[model samples]
Target: MRRLLLVSCSVAGLLALLPASGAVAVELPMRKAGLWEMKVLSGGSVPEMTMQQCTDATTDKDMSTAMAPMAKEICSKQDIQKTATGYVTDSVCGISGITVKSRAEITGDFNSAYTVKTSSQSEGGLAGAARDSNSTIEAKWVGACKADQKPGDIIMPGGMKMNVKDMEKMKALIPKK
Candidate 1:
């Protein structure tokens, strides 16, 4: 369960870190409207996960709201610099008792497919364990959504379907000390 949570949180963090469209300092290019699938390959405490999401104009505009409750505990500052081929992101996020500093570079056209390379470190938390992880996400247009899937619907690797906002409701079900 812990591993699953970690995987879910990591995915959330990645999504939250993605540059949103608007007057923000760094805005990622908008993707094509369609069903997009992301494949996560992690080599740290986080397990691999695959998630498919339906993206339309509305959902694309409201993407910043898709994250776990734990993400609220993180205070982040990001700077994006455009490169010749892509954009580079430097971000510092404080999570739990650790401050994660990461640098990521994104390349390729945002409409069909793109790649992100990230490296991060932590100074405190769980015996000050410093974990380094990198992931590659390949997203492509998969046509229209199915009858059961709607915009903002996310399907997890194990066939779990959820709306990212529902995470808070699920967390409320857990007993706290």
Candidate 2:
């Protein structure tokens, strides 16, 4: 009797573990457009210097030279998809010799058909200028799947390519207290 009981228990347990046949399957929601945003604050000012003056600065020249090469290397490392639309603005304030602030916004949809939008801004002091400079960049994306996708997944589409890694590096350039 004990042996018989053990066999019955084992069979019952195994049967219970099996899935029920003819069960209906549930489908997940389809991907959709989303919005994203990023903000960056750096050290510097652009108010005192015009576009030409800022471009002429040694620091600006160095940065321009460095970025040209860096862009190619970094862009390949960061594979991003989707269209991005944004702009850059610089302003100067106070007695600062040349303070500058720049902002860029991006928006696009991923392979999954999820939409993404983002904005980034940064401010800093121009090279060979007086006064301390401060800059800030803010980016925001909204839509479905945004909460699910990591920052790196959102690609800046079109010829204007960028990635979260680049943003992070740019953020690091900002001055901190």
Candidate 3:
């Protein structure tokens, strides 16, 4: 009975947050068009990561539009609000039986540099236990993309290069549990 009550409350909380969650994409300020280098500092579950991308306003918008469907499929709540200091985002995303609740604070001018700090809690899964983690992504604008690079091109570690538009194709390669 206690477990049922907790489950019921969780569902209710999620539903209440999305009274009008339709497919609306939140409007965000665009970063200056250029090459960007992003460093991710995450202490748990995975090691730190670094990547570079060539992006323009159109590329950013297209990436957001393309990811909407996947996000809606897994996330029940995703809210972004402008705060006095910066922007705050809260999301509840679940896959299989594991649910992850995360909150992120974003700051800095999108033109030159930006930072995103996130803290997340997970339960009802994660190897049959719960886990918590925090991460920060710091990004800075570089001069420009390489001559051979195009908009939406991302250079990952080990010199792996991929375009944002190709993400959907790679998604199919992931095994579903």
Quick one: best TM-score, which candidate? 3
lDDT of 2 by residue, 1-177 (tens): 333222222222211111222233111121123333322333232221101011112332343334433333322221122223422221111112322221222222221222112222112334443322232323333343343444334333232334333443663453432
lDDT of 1 by residue, 75-106 (tens): 35566778898888776666456667777777
Ranking by TM-score: 3, 1, 2
Give stretches of model 3 more than 4 Å off.
1-26, 44-46, 124-126, 170-177
Please state every model's RMSD to the true fold in angstroms: 4.4, 27.5, 8.2
Please name the candidate that would achieve the greatest lDDT relative to the true structure.
Answer: 3
Q: Please give the CA lDDT of all the candidate structures.
A: 0.63, 0.27, 0.69
Q: Lowest summed-lDDT stretch of 10 residues in model 1?
A: 66-75
Question: Model 3: per-residue lDDT, tens digit, 7-49?
Answer: 3233323222222245754455777888999886765445567
> Which residue pairs clash in candidate 1?
none
Candidate number with the higher TM-score (1 or 2): 1
Candidate ranking (lDDT, best to worst): 3, 1, 2
What is the Å distance of residue 177 in model 1 from its true position?
A: 20
List runs of model 2 lying over 4 Å from the truth: 1-35, 39-127, 145-159, 165-177
